[model samples]
Target chain A: MELVEKYLYAIGKKLPRKQKRDIVEELRSLIIDNLEDRVKEGEPTDEDISQILIEMGSPAEVAKKYCTGTQWLIGPQLYDMYLMMCKIVLGALLLGYSVSIVVSLFSSLSGSGFGQIMWYIAKNLLSIIPGILAAIGAVTLIFAIIERTSKKPLDIDFAEGGKWNPSKLEPIPKKEEVVKPIESILGIVFTVFVLVLFYFYRDKIGFYYMSSLGDNWVMVKIFSQSALRTYLPLWTISWVLSLGMYIWLLCIGKYNMLARVFEMIVSALNIGILFFMANGPHLFEFDKLGADFIDLQPAVDFLTNNQSTIFYILAVLSIFGLLANLGKLIVGKVKGRI
Target chain B: MGNNQHTTDGLIQELRRGTLVLSVLSQLKRPQYGYSLVQCLAQKGLNIEQSTLYPLLRRLEKQELLKSDWELTGTRPRRYYQLNENGKEMLQELSDEWNRLAEVVKKLTQEEEIK
Candidate 1:
């Protein structure tokens, strides 16, 4: 009985503090009672008592039986959601950090002083927004997982027979109650606002910036005259495409399947646009417009020096975003099944 | 002849087995110590093994159907068991159901035997 007490104590120590004492006392009483009954039946040997204890099963098994009720609050159902959130957050952070470092290096190499430094910092911060969101999401997901696994109130439903009868209990509103519609509305409003802003501010924004010119004689002359001209249209086109994609995503991306398909299409369009912009003029005979454009030296140098690197970076980021959306889609599918 | 007797005894045991739990529960409604309870039930023709009765008592206590209190009478302390509130309710329901089912079974079996 002393040995059994010691065994029970060891097992009880593993359990939560609140339950340990009652369980230990009950176990002790049971063992002693059994032992005394055995002794009266003429099986009074020490060896026999030890053999009986051994035959009854391990201390852990006994402890487990006592602790079996209400094992988890949210249960084992939401484990997949936790894992998916983890992947998204980690991937976002990795992508953000890499892009920040690369962009910072480019800005420093370009030698564009204090304004450029401020721009670099602002851009990096903006780029890291998704990463920060991912981190917060990951932390929340971990808390949710812990809450699910712990057999606590608010998450646990402890009725006999393993069926979730919601009619028996009150329901709490879900997180998506406020955020989902708000997010969709904000996304659409922001996209439309940016488009309008760009349309109205085009001239003011591009006044000193000579790269807004089309492929006319005057525009060719302007391009030949200015070193920044060739790069401006490229930036404008890229920005418009990005904004277009954002609006498209906001409009049609409520469903995971549609969002994933849209993401793929946008990713492909980005790559295709970058490819054409990098090599378009050479194939289109825009080089043969006049003497001013015929040289093509300034435009070629500008495109050669900057286009490939910029396009490569954008392509990578877009692919990363696409992969993140894909991750979201897979998570949604898994969550649906669960 | 002894083998035939043993077979008949085993058949009787099997036939009477389902009533053992109800019989034990009914006795424990009145506060009774373990050994005394066993002797009392045996006198009523519901003979049960000590091993089986002890475990069943413990299980009932665990299920909150039985309550026990230890009283030291003479040299050794004896644990007395009694039916709890839940146990009383369950016992009443079980008794009612058993009577109804037994009557139906008796009617059917008697009619078949007559035919």
Candidate 2:
């Protein structure tokens, strides 16, 4: 009686885990008991069991009494969709920034060059972080609505094949495909931590060099108060943007074309911003050159005056990093790792 | 059926829905298997869907109002259900409540009849 077995199996799919086996066994016996009582008068056929199953009603309706506590903001069913929305937002941000960089390159070929521009963008990475938080919030809000409004949670097959199997429940992610949400979250936290540190206690960035003369030590204030005050507004903007990148990474769990492009844009912008900031101010202070370091005073002063040059040099070196990530993104896309 | 009959069916189903647990509990004093319970209820002119009754029995069992066990009798296995101590207590309380409700309904219906 494959038909009868199939019916029991369908009903079995709906029962809670602990009670599934016992309920199925008891139900099977009941159905068989009914079948035998009917066939006592004559021979049994599949048709008889089919009629029995029909009278039993839907498996969902039967399963309803047994099921408990499915209410949630975004249950397992909508988790993937929520993640997708986050990816789309992040990807859009990345594309927008990349396009902006490309446009800037085309228009502004006269001043401070690519290196300075990239360094400027890199430094402002902090201000962009809040955008990530907002994107995640938006996705969560939409999914919460969907979860609440859905008439029947079971209407969507949260599990593949409409029945849960341990093997199929959570397939092992490939190395390249893993999202590393923890790492992304940590990076966001680190960024926020740095911002807080910079705001409250930034004068501690100088050098403590021991003099060769006689254990005489002197402290140099490397970072100026003006760095925090003047750049606070710009830093806030870039921090919010950086927050978006981290949040998108956390929510989406993995990088795709969009994330890669977003990364590229963010990297480019960061480098550019750092370069721009370098051009604007001393950015660093080495006023306490001491007696021994007076010979290097001219070099220190030149670097201090042209801090943007250092960022430009660093930005050129970071191109290798951006290229490597872009390569990984391309490869991951081809392999369906994304 | 017509719209009038549709409303009647829906209303009657709602009425029957409330009494299903009571109806099943009334008969679980003696051990009865799935088909046997269905036949017992059907014979008494209380029609319950076989699918409905089986799950209902399982739910009542879960609620500790009914207990069930599988028995191998004759050629095959059969699951026999009987009211447990909890079920007996519930049945008694529910029976008393049903009686009061039925009495009140009868009085009201008699008034309708008079009208």
Candidate 3:
């Protein structure tokens, strides 16, 4: 009985005080009833009682059955709130640190001395503060939305004898049920159109500006004069092919796989283009290229001369596009059948 | 139209069933043990079963919306249930919404009767 009490207490401690006594009392009675029954059957030894208790199962198991409907975590409920708050605070801090670093780097590079660096850091911190607050606000807003939408009770049951069954929970809204195929088709078409527009307008938008300023822009003149003129047509062609593939995939209702493949291909090609644009000039001097290839000089020279900067920009843009596309793909996947 | 009436009744029952938890939560603002709570609600015509009430109390306690503690009343220790802070806030909001809904429903039904 003492052993049973100890076991019951251990389990009861995990439950709310309101349930603890009832569950403990009920469990005690059960063990006593079991023991008495066993004794009546002529097994009166202490060893027999111990064996019977063991057969009844571990103290944890017995307590679990009695407190089957209770929930227990490592600590109080407020601890969860604290953890959530900490995550938000830490995320904000990291974003602030990165922004500060970028601002400082730019300020120093532009010949803004120590004072300017400090000012930039302060300005960056101030700018990021609202963003952090907005992120936190967004999280809260999402929580409110979920709370408002959720029709079920707050309890989550995961116990041996608990009546809680996850299967009984409402089914998640299916992706296909929510998003129609037409919407996805439109999205794919829109992205392709944007890519095509950019490709066609490459030269007019001063694609060669980064390599050759032509006495128009200081930043443009400083950078390599690699005219992306040659790659423009190829890029446009690739975009059209990728767009066609996307449309075909969407029509067949295989948007996810198609988007992933397309993103990977585009990212690879963009990275390659950026690399060539940055390194082509350094790899082959203008004297070697002769006057006939002067037009191509800007593209090659820009790539070779400003390889790091070009790579950084392309990598960033590619990664950003990849992430955006990946997000859409995942949303589409989760919204299954749509 | 006859089938529609039946469907509407069913929908009303379904809606009430969904709000049963909220109703339970509202009643548990003051400390009331399990049997007492069941009796109190039954007297008020909520008509909740013991099996349902017990499980719901457990669930509410688990959610931290309700707090429970055992008191040695008589020979048997009885578990007393009370609404927690979050439960109080939730009950207030739900009550306001419920009242507003009831008013709207009453006005709509009255308008229908006139028609």
TM-score winner = 2
Residue range A298-337, candidate 3, lDDT tens digits:
7867765666686668777877787787787778778767
Q: Highest DockQ, which number?
A: 2
Instruction: Report RMSD (Å) for each prediction in the order shown.
Output: 16.7, 21.1, 20.7
> After best superposition, candidate 2 residue B110: deviation in angstroms?
4.6
TM-score of each: 0.39, 0.46, 0.31
Model 1 lDDT per residue over B1-115, tens place: 3568888989988877777777888988789876677678989887776545655676678789999887776665567889999999988988998899899999999999999
What are the per-candidate TM-scores when only chain A is compared? 0.35, 0.44, 0.29
Q: Write the per-residue lDDT of candidate 1 for residues A100-146, one digit (tens) a residue.
A: 45434443334456677677767876866775776666567665666
- How far does residue B43 in candidate 2 sit from its true spot (Å)? 0.9
* Weakest ten-residue segment in model 1 chain B by summed lDDT: B49-58
- What DockQ does each candidate score versus the true complex, computed on alpha carbons? 0.07, 0.35, 0.02
List per-prediction Cα lDDT, in the order shown. 0.59, 0.73, 0.59
Worst 10 residues of 2 chain A by lDDT: A101-110
After TM-score superposition, what is the CA distance of residue A66 in candidate 2 from its true location, in Å? 3.7
Residue A235 error for model 3, in Å? Answer: 29
| Residue lDDT tens for model 2, B17-105 | 99999989999899988788899999999998876777778778878998888888787777888999999999999889999999999
